[model samples]
Target: MSEAPVPTGLFSGITRLDHVGIACRDLDASIEFYRSTYGFEVAHEEVNEEQGVREAMLRVNGTDDGGATWLQLLEPTRPDSPVAKFLERHGEGVHHLAFGTSDVAASAAEVGGRGVRVLGDGPRPGTAGSSIVFLHPKDCGGVLTELVQSAR
Candidate 1:
């Protein structure tokens, strides 16, 4: 019997679990809760009008290193925003999981070539000036996934 060929190039550039996005009603409250309860510190915060979210990246553990994983809290900027729609359906919880990649465009192309549906036409602007592309939840085992390429 012939052995099946191994698939290549799918997520091969992914380096680490970059962040976990959490959808919330209030950004400040969520940030405060994480600070007081888990002692997490906000590393960055910004409003992404294109994505329709006001988000904060909370550094897990300490800030002494650049490799710490982040918890991204996302609050919708408008009622018609994607985050708001997610909140309406799921009532505030984990939204997506992001993986760090060296090249978002290459990763996206490889994944898309393998029949997995990527969300947009191409990589979009992400937090911290990174480039990002989202994979459909249905194609990603029912969990939304994002590929992030940090700004150089």
Candidate 2:
């Protein structure tokens, strides 16, 4: 009989909550709401074509030593995209949580073996050159999960 390959530790450790994705019908409107009501400062913003999302990161003052971070907005580019579908059904709310990983490939493989459905077949290039993969919500108790391996 063939031996099962040893599973490796992919995540050096879950570093932190990289970001919390929020599905929104209107990215601009949701951003404004966070700014006006919560005073969150926009740290960065960008558009991802492959995933078809326009997103922004917000810095929440006093959450960290000085300020912590949270993802304020993400709007799907098309109605057919996953984020768009989520908003249509759920009407805007927490979409997913991203965790910083050390080795995305190994983490994905391990999770996949446990019957968790992964979005990408393998690690794909993501924002900021990080290798990333998405775990389908069906296996994760209705929460989309992203494992991101830092480029550095």
Candidate 3:
């Protein structure tokens, strides 16, 4: 008989908050609002064809430890994209909170074995050369969550 997966807190090996993803109807306008209103600067911006979204990462306050957080704005590039669906359901709001991981594949395995609904079979390439996977919101306190391992 095969051994069952062990249950744990599902937070082991997590490092830090990578970014807070937000869904927006318009990318440029949202970017403008953060810049003009909050004086936030875009650290990175790109269109992820695989994910079907145009995204911008705005830098938040920096800490003395040199750690940084980001406000990730996601704009759908297609009508049927996840971001589009999120907009339809939530009407422009926080989409997912991404946490940094030292080993995404391992983290995904651990989190998935703990009864979390992982969005994919495994982690895939994300923006800024990161490996990422999402945990379904239904199993994550009604908030979508992403786990990211920095490409090393």
Q: Per-prediction TM-score, please?
A: 0.88, 0.78, 0.86
Candidate that scores best on lDDT: 1
Candidate 2 global lDDT: 0.76
Tell me the spans in candidate 3 whose CA falls farther than 4 Å from its real position: 1-11, 62-67
Query: What is the lDDT of every predicted structure here?
Result: 0.88, 0.76, 0.86
* Tens-place lDDT digits, model 3, residues 48-105: 9998999998989663323467899999999899899879887998989987767889
On residues 46-118, what C-alpha lDDT tens digit does candidate 2 reach at each position? 8888888888888653322222446748899987888898888888899898776667887787778888888
Evaluate model 3: give its TM-score. 0.86
The numbered model that scores best in TM-score is 1
Give candidate 2's TM-score. 0.78
lDDT of 1 by residue, 1-152 (tens): 69985553355577667899999999999999999999998989999999899999998743222455799999999999999999999899999999888889998888889888999789999999999999999998999999998888
Q: Cα-based RMSD of the predictions, in order?
A: 5.9, 8.4, 7.7
The regions of model 1 sitting more than 4 angstroms off are 1-11, 61-66
> Could you give the candidate ranking by lDDT, starting with the highest?
1, 3, 2
Off by over 4 Å in 2: 1-12, 61-69
